[model samples]
Target: MNRIQQKKDYLKQSLSLLRDKFSNIPADKSVIHKVASPLRLEHAKGIVADAILKIMNDHNLQMLALLVNSCRSEVVKILNEYSEKYFKELKWAVIDEFGSVILKLNTNIATHNYLLPPLLDDLEESSESSDFYAKSTNYFSAINQNLLKIVIYHWRLFKNATEQGYLSASELILKSNVSQASVSNFIRYSLEKNYLLKHKIHNLYKFNNNCLEDLLEDWSFYYKNNYGKAIRFISYDTTYSIDTLLLKVKVLRDHNIRIAIGGFLALELQKLNYVSDIPDIRIYTDNIKYTKDELDLIEYQSQDDVTGRKIIELVSPKAEASIFSHIMNKDIPICDIIQCYLDVRHKASRGMEQADFIKKSVLL
Candidate 1:
């Protein structure tokens, strides 16, 4: 598709999402038509701005509630400047994109009416052609995955060092196996964010212990942002227990499968015994097709699918090599402590409990 067509389609999808979110409120089709019109393609920014203004005017309360919860600082500033009454309502809307609750309205309103945050997120993801639209919905766009890798590398070094070690860009590039450009960017960002304390006399960087919590929080979002939706299969093997399945998978190591175990199974492998019932087994691999083909011999999609079966999640991450940056236990490969924490923290099935146990007992 042409770029213009793609942009129009994106605008239409964004409008459709807004309609789905606020089903009770009738959509202003006139404003939507103006926003989605191919003839007005050159004036995309103006069209979007006009559409937002119209939406705000039409559904003032809903727009106000969403803006207050938005991560875009500029949007919040504009809302505060124009609508002072919503200032009091701001305190109740202190929720992030990943949070379960966004806004707490005292009045009776449909819960779905104030879902503009996700719509804004959609725009931020799809509207890269226009800087105006992108900046208007900018939400945690600063979190860099390369920075996450560098942070992990620094942490690994920090734990073993007798004294706090200072990081050099060249040394970082060599140790982390990241590109030279990425290392330079990470150092600059770290210095600005105080993730690293810079030496006054020499150009050296040391990891700031205080920023560990914040970095981990960013890593959680990075993990979710990248590998949230994974390709999974329900392995209905009534023949083998979860432990037995682990053995079956481990034997495939000889086939040159780049697999690292994660989720509840990783914790179990460490003999942490934090969880009694494992919901699913998560695996990170560079080669999905190969992994699936080999594992299919033991358990594959069959006509006899049923409930109470084990789930196997096959996640292909952008950082394929980093997934294997783990410590082995009893010949079982597992994702490192930090990766495992992020993998299970956001899960709904008592995952936070397990993650908390890891954080307090291991990470802390």
Candidate 2:
């Protein structure tokens, strides 16, 4: 967080970005003009020495001096090549963290500008630039997931205890296992936000008319924002009708495999009639690995040819099912509308539109 630490993170990120950018290039290729190109660093690629000099000149002089002065023998040797004045760009330079240059630069360069390029991101979510949820807009924010967790926990508890017992704030703290300070803050915030209502008889707490829905949305968005990559996309050889999907799911269900359709499939289940290139069938399964036999069984049962099937790792399969309704009387179960919305909200395709429509018509 300090000036020096910030700069170190910046340098590391920039170096990492360059490494990722040219990851496709052959490591042992002649693109590198190393004083002695080590096998490990043969893959290194980035702006040429001239550009580095340009970067050095454009940036702080003190940091560059320290970079040069603190160089390890290898870095010194690398810099030795750049000792001579060069004007034009060098095609492929070895911009690797080969030596202790990073540590040396940090120790020697006392001060540096923290300005740097954006960091890399996960594949699917990073590609999505939707304003659908406004999670990043900071409109409705939580310091941590604790608030949502506590609220959902208490809501479920209240429902279970409605007949025999009356729940109070003290009991909530005891049940939540959260700190007293945090508990008090959450209670106050929920009350102020009209999410919680106090029972007149025993001062028990319950959700306001729409509090439960909002709480679930917050929870889903939290997972979607933090763990979108888990929603793995798959292709199916053939388009599946409701009857075929039902059969496929029933086969898995009979085997006790936990499965739920999400993404475009869920939209179809919800009767949205949304169509796609191959009908992105995203299924959340608890099973880490599936057998070829099981898939073959599904194929035999469904009789619907498919191109591909994408798999998304579920954070909490049981929890998701508990919050959403299970498809009725189907050979297999499908995720309720809420889970479907969460699954596709972060997708890069027409995912936002699907999620939004579901949220408005089904979830809300």
Worst 10 residues of 2 by lDDT: 62-71
TM-score of each: 0.59, 0.40
Residues 222-296, model 1: lDDT tens digits: 556555477777654555466766675687665567788888888887776487888778888778777876666
Question: Which candidate gets the maximum lDDT versus the true structure?
Answer: 1
Candidate number with greatest TM-score:
1
lDDT, candidate 1, equals: 0.54
| Model 2 spans > 4 angstroms off | 1-194, 200-204, 209-217, 231-245, 273-279, 291-293, 297-330
Q: State the displacement of the C-alpha of residue 306, model 1, in Å, after optimal TM-score superposition.
A: 4.4
Instruction: Report lDDT per candidate.
Output: 0.54, 0.43
Query: Taking the tens digit of each residue's C-alpha lDDT, what string does model 2 give over 105-147?
Result: 3222331222123222222332332222123233223332434
Lowest lDDT block of 10, candidate 1: 63-72
Report model 1's TM-score to 2 decimal places: 0.59
Q: Which pairs clash in the backbone of model 1? A: none
